[model samples]
Target chain A: MERILAILVKDRSGVLTRVSGLFSRRGYNIQNIAVGRTVEPGVSRMTVTVDADPLTVEQIVKQLNKLIDVLKVSDLTDEPAVERELILVKVKAEPGRRSEIQQMADTFRAKIIDLSPDSMIIELTGSEQKLQAFLTMMQEFGIKEIACTGKISLLRGSKVTCDMKI
Target chain B: MRLTGAQMVLACLEAENVEVIFGFPGGAVLTLYDEIYKKGFKHILARHEQGAAHAADGYARASGKPGVVIATSGPGATNIVTGIATAYMDSVPLIAITGQVATPLIGSDAFQEADITGITLPITKNNYLVKDINELPFILKEAFHVANTGRKGPVLIDLPKDLQAQEGEFYYPETVEISSYKPVYEGHAGQIAKAADAIKKARRPLLYAGGGVISSGAHEELLQLSKMMSIPATLTMNGLGGVPYDYEYFLGMPGMHGTYAANNAINESDLLIAVGVRFDDRVTGKLEDFAPRAEIIHIDIDPAEIGKNISVQIPIVGDCKLVLKELLRRLQPVEKTNAKKWCANVLEWKTSKPLHYSQEPGDYLKPQFVIEEFYRLTEGNAIVATDVGQHQMWAVQYYRSQKPRTLISSGGLGTMGFGLPAAIGAQVAFPEKQVICFAGDGSFQMNSQELATAVHYNIPVKIAIINNKYLGMVRQWQELFYGSRYAHTSLDGSPDFVKLAEAYGAKGLRVAKAEETAATIKKALEIPGPVVIDFQVDPEENVLPMVPPGTSIVEMIGGE
Candidate 1:
């Protein structure tokens, strides 16, 4: 099962290495990870997607909580939440196929962020499913280069995760 | 008052009420040593950095306080790596202070500079590299707090020379406020209730205890719970001293090298209350087959340890002492007849396959006999530290510990050269109590230099070297698994341990005959200074009740 874990950790040097080192050392398969500054000044939030069984996932959470810098860990997989991933894909496009590519981008609400004579870069931000579908469609035109920002997520409603008393 | 970083270090240590420090002086740590001398904190200078770390660890284990050790950078810092890892593996509370190069020269690889924090990341519970002088006091305070609190382990603080020399305002915090590090002490009522109900209903129940029972000072609670429900108890290697060895309900140690009764009981029990045990591979021969019929109730302070090794039926995440107390309070007192049948069966196994070795008036001394004599001579009142090897297992099997915190050994890392330094620390911690180190010939040589430290301090720690003339444990494994090839296991060029002891200004005795074992031990014990007694034992003897690798605990080969 694929599980998403939101981890809040102190903003200190080498903390990222420490957290990632733990995952690698324990043989936990990290599918994707996105790290960014949190609302607090000296804290960072990391969203990690891992493929493991329920027991293994629980072990990972507990291990993450053991790290001194890791402030909070939550399994967002079962929670009602909104998740998004961004991708910038450069697709080979000739003059004749450009129109079709533009129409497809428009349908997916994606934007042509960059363009060249033989290729066009399309930027898309959406749920992982939407991003995967758009990538599959672009693969038809030969994706020359690709980059992705791993999924980041937020819970729905007023279920605040950051403001919980530490 | 303005103070140097070194002064702040001492101030924070004093604030934490640290009475003694085990450390060695080096160029990088000169300023800190100067401050230590000026402030007059009792410091024992170890012969090696590793000895310093192990000594501190032994002090902590004996006194239930965080052990303190200081070392210089580069080689000095790296030397303590083994000790740090040993302490980390055993969950011994230790605070290691290392002096680093000047801040500006940190990344440049200046003289005597090593990234001590980076080197110790995996081994330490937590570590800090002090970059600013102002953070010195807080870092020191936090180091001790992190070391001594919840699932205690070693913590390191790397102090740069420049920072140690720089003056700063030092303020030791009255209380640490680490938001993420609040350890859960009290067990959840719901989990405690479930545990209690399981105990109430269990017919064939066994209590599997570990070092956490000793670390949390919960021996009394464990005894009460076992007595209340008549549950036979078994201990892990680290858990040996938690319950008195001769306790009626105690089933002895379990897993590899475990007694037949303990292993058989674990296999047959329906309910296993595993407290503070990590279910190590040595303790669980084959995980899939370990305690096959048992529904495990794992009570541990670290949530990470609850289900990491085995599938726990009931998990209580809290301190062992607190959880055991809660379980005791919530549990209903049952009649002794409840587990009478099960106890009878366990006792039968115990009496039928009791631990035994040949004593047919041999020429050579038997290590087991030496340990037995030591136990008899000490009357089970001494603190026994041991190095990792056959002697370690024999010490655990033969020498009975009557109280908690008395049997200190390097269980997790199985580091050699731990016994002497650890005994030194134990002696320093309790000067009136007798401290003895049971070391193997291969193990004693690893840090035999510590004899000098003991002699200089007049620590009076007795060291019994089981001189088997081989790396006994590995030789046994080779003998069993590799057709007795004995590759690189022989200590052919070992030093004369007695001469080495005398060279260090300590008393030394050599016992070659079996009949002289008791008298030799008596003489060594009567010595006022540090004493090393070398007992030449059978070289080929192996630890019995052996569960081979990848085999089930029930499949034992040797004992009886």
Candidate 2:
């Protein structure tokens, strides 16, 4: 199963390399990860999606907590949460299939953000489930290229009061 | 302030309030040692690298601070492997530094080109391979921080020769930001509640305390839990004296060679509240039959430690001190009821005299007599370090270690020849207190070269060698398991230890009779230059209270 973990860590040099290196060294496959500074400066929050089992995820969480700069980390699966992902795809739209591709993209609610005479750039944002459905539908449009920002999450309907200092 | 790597090392040492470091001179570390000489920091040059490592370990154990050790590259670096591994197993905070080949020649297998980082990894909590002097102060700062924190194990820094030679605009960071390592501090409320509920429900509860309790300084919390809930407590050898040995609820050290009282209580416990212990094989004889009737509640600071060995009903992963506080909080409203019947049941299993050496008017000295007399002389206040063997067991069984962190021994690793140098380290760490060492003849032979180090430093450490002809533990195993085959445990030929000590310019004494131990020890302590007393103990005697491998914890055979 693919699982995503949201980690809050003190932002510093080598922190990203250390965290990623740990995953690689342990041979725990990481599908993708999105990291950026949070509203609280000097603290970076990362969402790591890993192709691992529940036990392996647990082991990873425990091991990650052992590192020095990690402040507060939680695997969001066990609790109520909201998760989202974004994907941008550019597809070829030949005259023979231009109308067909636009109709297909419109069906998936993927806005044709940019359109030229021969191709369309489509942007989609939704829950991972909806995004997967849209991506599955877009496969019929003769896809040219795609880029995705992995899952980002927040606890559902509640504010997270994170007070840990590095 | 601008400084060199060597000067930064001094500053780092100053930050940690380090008083002395144990090391030996070599070409690579010459500049660093020269810096030490000019800066006026106390550094004792040991005869061998292992001796320096052990001395550092002893100092750390005695002072409750990380011990610092320095050595040059190649053979010198390799020499401390056993010592590092010993500290790793026993959780001693030793910041060890090794001079490596210059950064440019690191992987080329240059002269004295040992892969120090790779070589030392298995023995260290963590290691750093520094290629630049700019990172030196920061690394050293981090080294001290990491070495002295989070489980408190040895950390190594392999400093290359060029890195040491180069100067840097170095400043020590007040703190480091290591993003990957975040240790848990507070115990979860839910887990604490579950633990309290276990205590409330169980009829026979045992609080199994380990070294981590002492390390966390959780004695008061442990005392509260034991008294408030009427939980009987048993300590591992490392956990001895965490609670007063005289407490009604206190059972002695538990394990293979555990006291009858301790093993019996462990067997009878309905709820085993293991606090800060790893539950090593020594404690749990056979996995299946151990704690046969109990629901194990393993409360450890490390999450990975939970359920690593014994299955647990409640696994509380948090600091021992915090966990104990939460436990006390949970039990406040609960009424206290003494497990009087259960305590009495464990008491019935105790022997009249737990450690009695023969007073049958024999001339041959007994190892027990030396420790028993040592205990009497010091009143259990003096710190003791021992190498592995029958002598180490006798030190634990005989010496009443009333103070926390007083009894230092190589427990899990059981490294022979650890005593004398460790005692020197302990004495250096605590100059006001008396430090004693118990060494078996075989174990003494391993690091006896440090005797010269002791004399050179003029550290007042009392050394007592239990001079049996053979390696006592191996011989005991041979007797019991291999039909007394006695393959090669004995030291067939060796120099007389008394004569050897005399040659090293230290006071020496040889005891032939059991009656002579107290006087010999007293005289040794009184004399100035690192006294050595060779006790000619009986060769055939064994460290009894042996629980055969794969047997139940309660089924140990003890000496009457």
Highest DockQ against the true fold, candidate: 1
lDDT: worst 10-residue window of model 1 chain B:
B358-367
Candidates 1 onward: DockQ, in order? 0.74, 0.21
lDDT of candidate 2 over B222-281, digit per residue (tens): 888888877778888788777876677777788888787778778878999998898899
lDDT digits (tens) for residues B67-176 of candidate 1: 99999999999999999999999999999999999888889979888888888888899999998898888888888888988999999999988888899987778889
Assess candidate 1 and give its TM-score to the true structure.
Answer: 0.96
* Residue B110 CA displacement from its true place in model 2, Å: 0.7
Q: How much RMSD separates candidate 1 from the native structure? A: 1.9
- Each candidate's interface RMSD: 0.8, 4.3
Residues A1-166 of candidate 2: C-alpha lDDT, one tens digit per residue? 8877888887865567657867876678888888988888888998998988877787788767765656877887766878888899888787788788778777877788888877888898878888878777777776789899988888876557245544
Clashing pairs in 2: A66-B181, A67-B180, A67-B181, A67-B182, A68-B178, A68-B180, A68-B181, A69-B178, A69-B179, A70-B179
- Give candidate 1's error at residue A3 in angstroms: 1.2
Worst 10 residues of 2 chain B by lDDT: B350-359
lDDT by residue (A36-94, candidate 1, tens digit) is: 99878899999999999999999999999989999999999999999999999999999
